[model samples]
Target: MFNKIVLENGLRIVTENIPYVKSVSIGIWIEIGSRFENQSNNGISHFIEHMLFKGTENRTAKQIAESIDSVGGQLNAFTSKEFTCFYAKVLDEHLPLAVDVLADMIFNSKFNEEDIIKEKNVVFEEINMYEDSPEDLVHDLICQTMFDGHPLAYPILGSSSILEKINKKNVLDYYKQYYTPNNTVISIAGNFDTDKTIELIYKYFSNWIPVKKEKDEQCPPMFYRRIMGKTKNTEQLHLCLGMKGVPQGTNEMYHLMVLNNIFGGSMSSRLFQKIREERGLAYSIYSYPSSYKDTGMFTIYVGLNPNYVSTVLQLITEEIDKIKNGGMTSDEIYKSKEQLKGNYILGLESTSSRMSSMGKSELLHGKIYRPKEILEMIDSVQREDVENIAKEVLDFNRLNISFVGDINNNQIESNFKKIIG
Candidate 1:
């Protein structure tokens, strides 16, 4: 069960109490990320995530880390396409300390000029590390190709050139604009008294004033049918195929999940069986859906020998065609639903996972679906739903391709044209 409270300043706090557990997980979710940035400040959200850990007014970076470690607790943060989270896991008795430390960091993080300069170098190295990983780089390429001119295509780790020009003034201005009570949600799970937990949250967060600013209208990204390649000297070609998919918080998302599980989302999935298990064409091949506020993308990725690209692509197309031509069976759908249910239920065993799920749900959709409700939604998915979603999302004509390796651009273009046509 989940309990929620909304502060006078619009800050929302959500919690789930698990009496059997001795630990608690808490997360502060902010609904701002790379999508909120423009071309000039592309990586500022992630940058700010790093700065928050550097130091706070009352605590040095070492003390902040030691404060959690001394109590046998864990603390970390991450930035994604749609949001950012700073979280901690600690014993139930230490919940108040966790809250105080996190609040102090969020409220008093010193964005010193020297720290900014030092962190910029660190970010530059991080970008360099990303550049060296072609497998990871190819996924970013697919996004850049699929959403040709949208902010959704922007890299979460902005380029070195642009990041170099971002100074303290830019960082503070961007942080001030987006880091407000209304745009934030604090989610906690595991053993705690709900009444007392609410009081503790109020102590640290109730005074935060909501920022008055006009919200930016988000434009849905236009999916492009194009091929993009990066020439790199690597042993295997990393390729990604992208197409349109449904947005977040929709029944169609469940339908897509069922379809993905049968198609390429699992080890026993059709793509894995055909390409790797049978033919030995690739070591890694899988498909996933990336859903956002207003739009989404379904992507298929495979790393294979450059010479076998044509064979692997044809096999992938065959599998997609089968799904499009009513090849999925009732058994597959049933098993997938069971797999999803098991995965969801097992994930709840962890306090961190529960905290994350509640935070992301309330922060994005403004509602948290109970376990019973979610299981019912999954069980309600019928054959027609999966089949309809397959036909709608598996349009080869609109496919966009992105690849990285020693393969020639002309070769990739020729293979794509032949297989797709």
Candidate 2:
């Protein structure tokens, strides 16, 4: 069961209480990330995420870490394109301490001048590390090519030029604007008394004042069907193909998941079977769907021998064409639905996973779906739905291709256009 309450200030508190489990996972989900940023302030969300742990007024950075560690608890945080979360998992009894630490970090963290400079250098190294890995870098390249001029294309780690430009004032101002109680959600799952947890949350969070900020709706992403490549001395060519997809919180979103599973989401998927198992053309191949508040991306990734890029690209196009033209059978539809249902159910068994699901749902949709509700949604997908979505989204003419490897520009331009045409 899910329990939810919204504070007067608009902070949302959602919880799931599992009686059998002795552990509890708590997450503070903020409704701000890279998507809310522009070129000048890119990566500020992620940078502020790191800065939160540096220290709070009442707790030194080391003390903050030790407080959680001493209780045999775990604390961590992550920043995504749309949101940032700071979470802690501990024994049920430590829920109060966890709440206190999280609230303090959000409300009282001092973005120190000296610490800002140090973390800036650290983020610089993180950017360099990504540049060193071509496989990882290609995804960013694909995003840049696919989204083009949109803010969605901006790198989450940002660039060295922008990082150097960001300072304490920028961090503080951004945090003040977006870290209001109204822009936050606190989610907990696993063992807890619902009423007691609610009281505890109010105790820690009630005093934080809300800010008046205008709701900013993102402009629908304008996708460019671009074929871009970078030459790098890598062992194998890393290829990524992407197309615009349905946004989050839509009926088509579920159908797209079912479609991706049959196409390349798993080892039994068409791309994996055709490209890896049967032909042995690539060691790694898969497809995934990324849905945001207002836009989405369906992407297929493959790492293969540079010599076989043309052949692999041809086969990929063929499979995509086949699906668009009714390659998905009733059997494939049934199995993929079953697979999606099983995965969704199995994933919910963990407290952390439940916390994350509820947090995202509440922040994004203002509502949460229970296990049975989601399973029903998965079951409702049919063969025609998959085919229709594929036909609408899988046009070769609208595809974006990104490649990184030791390959020449002429080889890429000629071969990609030939296949795409």
Task: Put down candidate 2 lDDT per residue, 212-237, tens digits, no spaces.
Answer: 99967668888767877899999999
lDDT of 1 by residue, 150-176 (tens): 888899998999999999999999989
Worst 10 residues of 1 by lDDT: 215-224
Which residue pairs in model 2 clash with each other? Answer: none
What TM value does model 2 have? 0.98
Q: What lDDT is reached at residue 186 by model 2?
A: 93
Score each candidate by Cα lDDT. Answer: 0.94, 0.91
Question: For every model shown, what is its TM-score relative to the native structure?
Answer: 0.99, 0.98
Index of the highest-TM-score prediction = 1
Model 1 sits at a Cα RMSD from the real structure of: 0.8
lDDT, residue 310, model 1? 94
